[model samples]
Structure formats: structure tokens, C-alpha cells
Target: MLSVMVVAATLFSVTTVMDSVETSIEKGTARLGADIMVVPAEAEAQAKTALLAGEPSTFYMDRSIEDKVRKVKGVKAVASQVFLKTAQYKCCSVGNMLLIGFDPKHDFTIMPWLSKELTRPLGTDEIIMGRGLTAYNVGSKIKFYGKYFEVVGMLEETGMKFIDNSVFMPYAAMKKLAEESKHKKGVKAANLPIDKISTVLVQVEPEISPQRVAIFIEHDIPGVKAIVSEQVISSVRKQLFVLLRSILSISIILWIMALLLIGVVFSMIVNERQREIGLLRAMGAKKSNIFRLIMTEASILSIMGGIVGIVLGGAFLYAFKGFIRSSLNIPYLWPSAAEYAVLVAGCLLLSFLTGAVAALWPAIRSMRMEPYEAIRRGE
Candidate 1:
């Protein structure tokens, strides 16, 4: 039973982890809804980290670059964003967070998720939070640098940590915050690069290929790199797949060993029960009845162990999910309730089969024993 529990838990954990990584990447990219991201030449890695892990990547270029990218062929629209980290400023009391300054008029990706009441233009002192910031409500005020901004709205969950962990406001609002930060008495100056932007999100013309447009952007614009959205997801997929495959291989080996141990353990139990089995046969119990009795006992034990294992495994995963994500610096989202139910059902079925199959030979031997001969072996 103990062996089965360990094996079951291990198998469940690996399968859940793999599924979560794949789902998160798919959902996260879909939420982005943009064809390409253009960033400073050396900040490509930083941009990926910001998207995947929600870690602030403090790099910027002049806001004028937005105009240049728009003029490039095949580019239909351009939106500029500025990134800042709470750790850089005097607002350390609010904890570390990502600040995103977006052009709401040009931002199709984020604007669509804004609450209905917030459809109007946002004020310079107002900000919209991501769904992941559940602790704060719409009326809550967050102090940035030395100024406080009211939370005017909260966006829906995107399954992407980058957007979830970020706070969004207009470009002018962020600029105003920066300008005001310098005047606060005795406060450490929190300067967001004035008149600068971080990354440019681009949407390509319908007839033009995203990859082709990305290439053209890089060629036309100096000191900037264009990243097709899929490439970022693909890179993470390759890295996670390799890691998950290795974990799954180890789990398969452990499960096989547990199966063999169950067989050996059940054989010893049948030997010890020969006296009782002989008496039952002497009383006219059918061989088939004895076989079923043994199998029924094994099945019960296996299922109980499986259930316990699942409970422990699930608790561990849920409790440490945040820590695991932070350490890995990867985007991770749990499967929906229905999908998770299926996984749990599959594990339970595997557990039952493992015990039933291992007990087969022992049950056959017990049923084959003659009443008189079996009684002698028992003595």
C-alpha cells in the first residue's frame, strides 16, 4: 500500500506539471493578441522574462520610436508601453510590482478586457489593475513614487503572469507620476525615464505574414529587435518539454518497481492464509469464490492508497505552486476543474489495475490448492 501511494503521487505530480506549463503558454499568448514585440536590441531576454514571469525589465528607448515602427511596411498599428519596477522607487511599501504605461486608444489587447464602466478615458490619477491583484478593489489607492493613484478598474484574468501582475495606466499618467516624484519632500526620487517607452507592440496587415513583418521591423529600425509572438512561446516550450520528459521517465520506473513489489507481497500473504483457505474449501466454497475474495481485498487496498496519495500530491502542488513558478521563472496555470477531474479519475483507475494484476497469480495458486493437501502444507 505504501509503495503504491508513493508511485501514484509521483505519477500524478508529473502529469499535472506538464499539462499546466503547456496550457499556460497557450492561454498567455492568445491573451497577448499582438503579432510582434519590438524592444531595445539588448533587452530581448528581459522582455521575455517580463512576459513569462512578470518580472520587471527596466529598459527603455525614446517614445519617438513608435512613429518609426508605424512607418514600416506591413505594420498596420503600433502601441507603445513603458515598464517600471516598484523596487526602483520610494514606493517600496507597496512591495515589488510591475508598472505598465499603455496608450489606451491604441491598445486593442488590454482595452478589450477593461470593465464596462471604465470604457471612458482614464484620469491621470487613475490606474487599472490586473485580475491577479485580487487584494485590491477598484476604490483602493496605491501610492507610486510619492503620488497615489486610484484603482479605477480591474482587467479580467489572462492566464499570463506578466499582465496579471502589472498595473496599467495611460502613458501621460506614468509621466506625470515621474514628474511629481521629484517634488516630494524627503522622499527618494523615483524617476521613470521621461519621454521614453519600453516595448512597441505591432499588429501586421492581414495580407502580410507576421514573421516577415518582424524581419522588416528589425531591418528598418536600428538598435531594436522584433520578436514574433510564437517564437517566444516556442522557446519556452522546448525548455519545459525537456525538463518534464526527464521527470516522467523517472516516475515510470518507480511505478514499475511498485507493481513488482505488490506481486511479491501478495504471494507471501497467500502462503500465510493456506489454513483458512483449506477450511473454506473443505466447507464447499468454490475455487472461483476464493479467487474473487482475494482480488476484492487487493482492489480495496489499492484504491484507498491511491486516494490518499492523490490528496497529498494535490496539496503539495497547490501549496508550493507559487514558489515553484517563481523559482522556475516560468508561466504556469492550473487546468480547469473539468480537466483536472479527468486526470484524477485516470490515476485512480491505474491504481486499481496495479493491485488487481499483481494479485492474479497468488489468487490462482490459492484457488488451485486441494482441501486435504492444502491443510497439510498449512501445518
Candidate 2:
């Protein structure tokens, strides 16, 4: 019973983490708010890496591509964004933050959500922060490239580290910063790369196929690669599935070993208690009562073992969540209280069933034993 509970708890924890991470990633991808992303052909891998790592990175292409993308057939809307990599210790309270520039007039990605949080459009010198940014809050001021900006709003958690850890500002503000940086002393102003954009976001018309639009953008646009949001997410899902399969395979093997060990242990226990069981039968206890007695003992042991296992497993998961996420390179969100309650109940129920099943044959054999013959054999 103890072995079974231990293996079951470990399996449960692994599956729960994997499921939570996969779900969070899917939800975060959906909230990205773009059907397709267009970036310089040389920057595709770096862009994906930045997205996954939630780190500041700079990659740029000609800003003119935005106009070409907007003119493409089936294009409903096109927004251009610039990525600025902040210095580790200069012009910012926090180090190595990613600064994103969005066009308020043309953006569909952040504006719709930003509108709900703020009553007015973002000012040129004001910024909205992602939830994962801990250093600044509403009304707090942050410096970027020697320029100061106030945090006007903060976005809700999106579970994607890239969006959650980034800071968003108006494109005009970023442009002004870039212009000022050229003359500013002691700053890496040359990194700004004026007249270039980091990426272009496209929203396809309702009747147009996103995949087709992505292909069109790739062919029509020079020096750029077009990525369909669904395809990118599907690729990520496939990678996660591979990890899940490996975990599941190991868990199955452990579970089978646990079950076999538990069965053997229970059989020995029943054999050792034969005299006591035979005595009970001789004293007017029915066969059903003997069976129930043995089953009840198994249930109690299973329940105790399960409780211990759950405590150990839950503690381990809670204590090492951050470490686990970093080590595994996966995003994870803890289950809500109600969801955890369900998981706990499931573990207990599975442990109980395993105990009952493993003890079934032994219990039946005990019940069918002749009292005198069993007592004699025991002596």
C-alpha cells in the first residue's frame, strides 16, 4: 500500500505540472492577439527564443515592410512594433527589460486590452507594464535610454513570460528616445537602428485563411518570414507532448512495479494472520465478515499511505515550482483550490481501489478456509 501510494503520488505530480504548463502556454498564445507575425528572415529563430525565454532581444527590418504588408490582399490590419533592449544598469530601475513600441493608431494587439485598463490612449511619455514586471507600478516612473516615462497602467497576467515581463510604450515615444539617444553621452544609442522595425503583426480579414495569408506574406515580402500563430503554437504543443509521453511511460512502469509489490506484501500479511482469521470464523463470524475484515485493514493502510504521499508530493511541488519551471523550461500555473481538492480526492480514491484489488484474492482465500484446518496449519 505504501509503495503504491508513493508511486501514484509521484505520477500525479508530474502529470499535473505538465498539464498545467501546457494549458497555460496555450492560453498565453491565444492572448497574443495576432493571427500572424512577420519578422526579418534572419531573426525568426531569435524571435521565437525571445518569446520563450521572456528576455530582451533586438532584431529589426525596414519599417517600410509595414506598408507593404498592409497592402497585401486579405490583410485586415497591420501594426508595426519595435523591440529595444535596455541596458542592464543604465536608464532603468530594473535591468535587462524588453521595451516594446506599439503604434496606438494602428495596433490591434495591445490597444484593445489596454483600453479596458485605461480611460485614454497611452501618452507619448507614459507606459503600460506587464504583470510579471515587479519593479514598477501604476504612477511609478521608469527611465529608458536616459528618458523618463510614467507607468500609467499594468496589464493582467497572461502566463506568457514574454508579454508578462515586457513593457509597452507608444511608438512615437520610442522614436523620440531613439532620436535623443544619438547625441546622448555614455549610452549605447547606436543600437537603436533608426527607421527599422522589430516585427509586424497582421490581422487577416474574416473571410481570408490565415495560413494562406502567411504564405502570401512570405512570398510577397522580401527579406522577411511570415509565421502563422496557430502553426507556431502547434509546434510548441508537439514538443510538450513529447515530454509528456516520456513522463507517462516511466510512470506506467513504476505503477506496475508498485502494484506487484503491494500484492505480494498483502498476500504475506494474510498468510501470517490465518490463525486469527480462522478463530474469527470459528466464533460465528460469517465468510463475508472475514472478507470485510481483511479488506477494511487494507483500506485503512492505503488511506494512511495516501495521506502521507500527498503531503510529501504537494510540498515538493509547491516548494520547487520556480526551480522546476526553470529547469524544465516550461510555463506553469498552480491549480486553484477547488482543482487541487479534486486532485487530492482522486489520489485517495485511486489508492483505495488499488488496495482493494490487490487484497481481493487473499481476502477471498482467507474467507474460504476451514477453521480447524487453517488453525492446525498455522500451528
Candidate 3:
């Protein structure tokens, strides 16, 4: 029973964490809102890292790339975005945040969701906050690049750190900040080139293949690499599958060892209690009674062990979740209360069944033993 409990608890906890991480990654990728992202060749790796880590990164290519990409075959539309890094200071209510600039006319990524929040297009000084921006509320002002902007809307939770912790504003507002910072001595914003952009988002025509378009852009464009969204997501999924397979392999080994241990323990108990069983049978107890007694003992032990295991497992998962996520470098979201409860119940039931099945052979042996033969053997 104890072995079963330990193995079951470990398997449940590990599976839950892995599943949560995978789900978060899938949802984050889906919400990226671009078919293909065209970034400077030198910045391709950094861009992927920033997207996965949910951190702010700045890398730029000439604005002329947008025009070139727009002219590519099978291109439906193209938009340019810029990344601006802010500093953490006393005057700033929100800590360091990534400021993203998008063109309202050509943007299809954030504008769809942004439009749902606001009745009008984003003004030059107006901005939208990500869900993770807890420092300020709607209608509050945020200071960035030595300027103040009004927060007109807030994005819903997407579980992706990049989107959740970011601030979105108009491309014109980003340009204005760049111009203003040129005269502000010692400001980091002045270092950013006004005519450069961080990324180019492409929307391929419905009948056109995004991968083909991405390939075309990569081959035709110089100093830029185009990435298809599905390819990136597939790579992430493959990595996750490798990790999950290792976990399952370990879990299966432990489970089998547990079953064998439980079976051996039950067999030993039955042998030591042979005299007691014989006496009960001599007093007219039926074979079914002997079987029931052994099975009942197994069930009780299993239930107790399962209860303890579930509590311990839940505690461990809750306590070390942050450490686990950081160590794995994966985002995690805890299941809701109801889902956790179901998981707990399922683990307990599994443990109980395992214990009962492991004891089945021993119970049957005890039930079939003759009273006189069992007593003689015990003596």
C-alpha cells in the first residue's frame, strides 16, 4: 500500500506540471497573432528567446524591409512594430516594461483585440496595458521615455509573459518619443534609430501557403529571416514531448516496482496469519469470510496511504511550483480548484485499486486453504 501510494502520487504531480507547461506554450503561440514574423537575421535567435521568456528585447532592421515584404507574392498585408525598452525608477509607477508600437492602419495582430476594448482607434498618447501590468489601473497614467501616456484599455489574460507584461501604443507615439529623447541628454531612448523597426508581421493570402511565403521572403530578402508560426510551435512541441517521455518512463518503472513490492508484502502477511485463518475456519467461518477479511485489510491500508499521499503531493506541488517553472524555463498555470479536486480523487482511487489487485492472489490462496491442513502447517 505504501509503495503504491508513493508511486501514484509522484506520477500524478509530475504529469500535472508537464501538462500545464505544454498547455501554456500552446496557448501563447496561438495568441502571437502573426502568420510569419520577419526579423533581422542577426536577431532571429534573440527574438525567439525573448518571445519564450516573456522578456523585453530590442533589435531593429531598416524600415525599407516592410515595403520590400509588402511586395512579396501571396502577401495579404504587412505591418511594422517597434520594441522600446523602459527603465525602472521611483517616478515610474510600473516597473520596466516593453513598449510595443503598432500601426493602426495595417496592424492585424493586437488591433483586433484592442478594438474590442475601445470604440475608437488608439490616439498618439493613449496606450493599452497587458494583463500582467498590475501596477496601474485603467484611466491611470504611465510614465515612459520621460513622457506620460494615458492607459485607455487593458488586455485580457493570455498566460504569455511577453504579451501580459507589455504595453502597446501607436507607431506615431513611438516616433514622437524617439524624437523627444534626441534632445534629452543621457536618455537611452535617444540611442534607438528612428527609421528602424524591430519586426515585420506578415499576413498571407488565404489560398497562399505561409511556409512558402516565408521561404520566399527568406531567400529574396537580405539581412532578414522569415519564420512561419506553425514551424516554431512544432519545434516547441517536440522539445516538450521529449521531456514528457522521460517522465513517463521513470513513472512506469516505479509503478511496476511498487506493484511487485505490494504483492510480496501481502503474500508474507498471508503466510504469517495462516494459524488465525485456520482457527476462524474451524469455528465455522466460510472460505468467503477469509477472503473478505484479507481483502478488507488491504483496502483499509490502501485508503489510509492514499489520503496521506494526496496531501503530501499537493503540498509539494504548491510549494515548489515556482522553482520547478524557473528550473524548467517553462510557463505554468495551476489548474482550477475543481480540477485539482478531481485529480486528487482520481489518484486516491488508482492507489486503492492497485493495492486490492496486488493482494488478490494471496487472498484467494488463503480462502482455498483447508482448515486442518492450515492448522497443521502453522504448527
Candidate 4:
């Protein structure tokens, strides 16, 4: 039973975490609606951090890159965004939060879905906020770098921190805010350059491969890096799995030890039960019956232990979901119903097999014993 519990717990916990990470990546990239993200060569890490964790970041690239990328073969559209960070101010709802300024015309991704939340066209004084900024409502006002902007819309949750905690506005509004921020007393001036863009989201034609387009973009442009959206997700998944492998190794060792312990325990129990088995044998119980009884008992305990471990492991993950996301700085989403079912089935099966295998030798040995001699040995 203990052996089964350890195996079940390890499988459940690991599967839940991996599923959440995978779900988050799929949802995040889909909502982003871009095949490629182009940024300054040096800001690659910073861009990933902001995109994954919703951490406030400030980075810029030449605005002219937007035109350069549009000229790339198979490029369908290009939208530029400016990234900004705020200084600590009493009026700011969230300190040092990310603020994004995007071109409304060329944006095919984030704003289209978010626009549904707006009753009218977004005004220059209005902003769209990510769901993580829960303290504010649609009509609420937020001050950034001493410039106040009204929250006009709220984005649906994307699991990606960048989308959840960010604020979005038109490119013109950010420029206006930057202009006003220069005169604000005791505040860090917005480090936005009128001629600079932070990131360029690119959508390519259907016939072109995103990876191929990304390579071309990088080759045609210097001082910039074009990252494939899928590549970013895969890189993060690989890095995290490498770390998880060590934990999985520990779980594997525990499983082996549990199996050995269960075998030893059942062996002791079988030795002590020789007298009982011998009497049953003398009473005409078949060897098959004795073997079946032992296997059945082991199977019952294994199933029960597996269930308890799964429940406990799932509850632990649910209780600490936030802590896991924050500590890892990664997006997470719970497994779908179908996914949970498959995982549960797999864990239970493994547990059952482990217990049954451990008890096999003990049951076989019991069946081979002669009745009177077995009773004498038990004495």
C-alpha cells in the first residue's frame, strides 16, 4: 500500500504540473496571434521574461524595423508595440507594472478580442488592462508616471502573465503620456523614444513557414532577432523539463525502494501465515485458491492506496497553484477533463501492477508447501 501511494503521488503531481505548463503555452501563443516576435538582439531574455512572468520591462528597437519586416517575402502584416515600466507612485494601482502601446490598425492579435469589451473606439485617454490588475474596473482610472488614463476595457485571462497584468493603449496615447511624463515632478520620466518600438509582431502568409520567415527576417536585419513563437514555447518547456528530471529521478528511487519494502513485508506476513495456510490446505482448499486470495488482497490495498495518494497530490497542487506560478514565473492552466481521466487511469494501473508483482513470489511459495510440514515449520 505504501509503495502504491508513493508511485501514485509522484505520477499525479508530475502529470498535473506538466499538463498545466503545456496548456498555458498553447493558450498563450494562440491568443498572441503572431507567428514571429522580433526584438532587439540584446533584449531577447528580457522579452521572454516579460512575456512569461508579466514582469514590467523596458526595451526598444528602431521603429523603422516595422517597415523593414513588412518588406520581407511572405510577410502579411506587422504591428509594433512599445513597452514601458512605471516608477513607484502612490496613485499607481500596481507599482512598476508593464504598459504596452500598440498600433490599432495593424494589430491582428490581442486587441481584436479585447476590442469586444469596449463599447466604442478606444480613446487616446483610455486603456485596456490585463485581468491580473483586479483592483481596477472598466471605468476606473489609473495613474502611470503621473499621467492618468481611464481603463476602457479588460482582457480575458490568457494564463500568460504578460497579457494578464499588462495595460494596453494606442501608440498615440503612449506618446502623449510620455510627453506629459517629462514635466512630472519626483517621477522617473518615461524612457520611450518617439522613433523607437519595443517589439514587432509579424503575421506571415499561409504558404510560408513561420520558422523559415523568422530566419529570413533575422538574415535581412541586423541588431535584431526574429523568434518563432513555437520555438519560444518549446525552449521554455525543455528548460523546465530538465529541472523536473532531477525530481523525477528521486521519485523513481522512492518507487523502487517501496517495491522492495512491500516484498519484504509480504514475505514476513507469508512466513507467519504458514500454519493458517497449511490448515486451509488440509481442508481441501486448492493451491489456485490460496494464490488468488493473496493476489486479491494485495490488489485491493494497492487500489485504495493509489486513490488516496492521487487525491492528496491533486489537492496539494490545487492549493499551491499560485505559489507554483509565482515561484517558477511561468504560465499555468489546469488539465482538461479528458487529460485528467487518462492520467488517473495510468497511475492506478501502475500501482496495481507494482503490488501484484511484489506479492507473486510469496503466493507461489505458499502454494508449494506441504500441509503438515508447513504447519510444523510455522510452529
113-181, model 1: which lDDT tens digit per residue?
765456579999999888888888889988888778899888767667888888998988888877777
lDDT of 2 by residue, 1-379 (tens): 6686686678668767766776667666666778888999998888777666675788999999999999888899998999987877575566688889989889777756552467688778899888778777788988877778998988766667778889999888888887887788876673677788999999999999999999889889888988787786678778877887787788778767766777788788878888887788789899999899989988888777778888888888888888977876644556667767877888788778777777888889889999987777777
Measured against the true structure, the TM-scores of the candidates, in listed sequence, are: 0.82, 0.86, 0.81, 0.83
Error of 4 at 359 (Å): 2.4
| TM-score between model 2 and native | 0.86
Give the root-mean-square deviation of each candidate in angstroms: 3.6, 3.0, 3.7, 3.4
Tell me the lDDT of model 1 at 352: 93
lDDT values of the candidates?
Answer: 0.84, 0.80, 0.80, 0.84
RMSD of 1: 3.6
What is the Å distance of residue 92 in model 1 from its true position? 7.0
**What does candidate 4's lDDT look like per residue over 1-379, in tens digits?**
8777877898789877877788888888887888899999999988888878777788888899999999998799998999887767664556788888999888776676673555466788899988777898788988887767898888877788888888999889989888887887876677788799999999999999999999899999999988888998998899888877777788778778877877787788889999998999999999998898888888888888889889888888888887987777788767778989888888888778877888888888888889998889898
In angstroms, the error of model 4 at 140 is 4.2
Per-residue CA lDDT of model 3 for 1-379, tens digit only, reads 6776687778678767766666667666666677899999999888886676677889999999999999999889998999877766543445557889988888877756542467787787889887777876689998776678998988765656777779999989888977886676554453457688999989899998999999889888988989887777677668876987788788778878877787889899989888889999999999999999998888788777777777777788889977876766544556657767777777778777777887899999999999998888887
Query: Against the hidden true structure, what lDDT does model 1 obtain?
Result: 0.84
lDDT of 2 at 358: 74
Off by over 4 Å in 1: 62-77, 86-96, 114-117, 131-135, 156-161, 180-195, 203-213, 274-291, 318-322, 334-336, 363-379
**Model 3 TM-score, 2 decimals:** 0.81
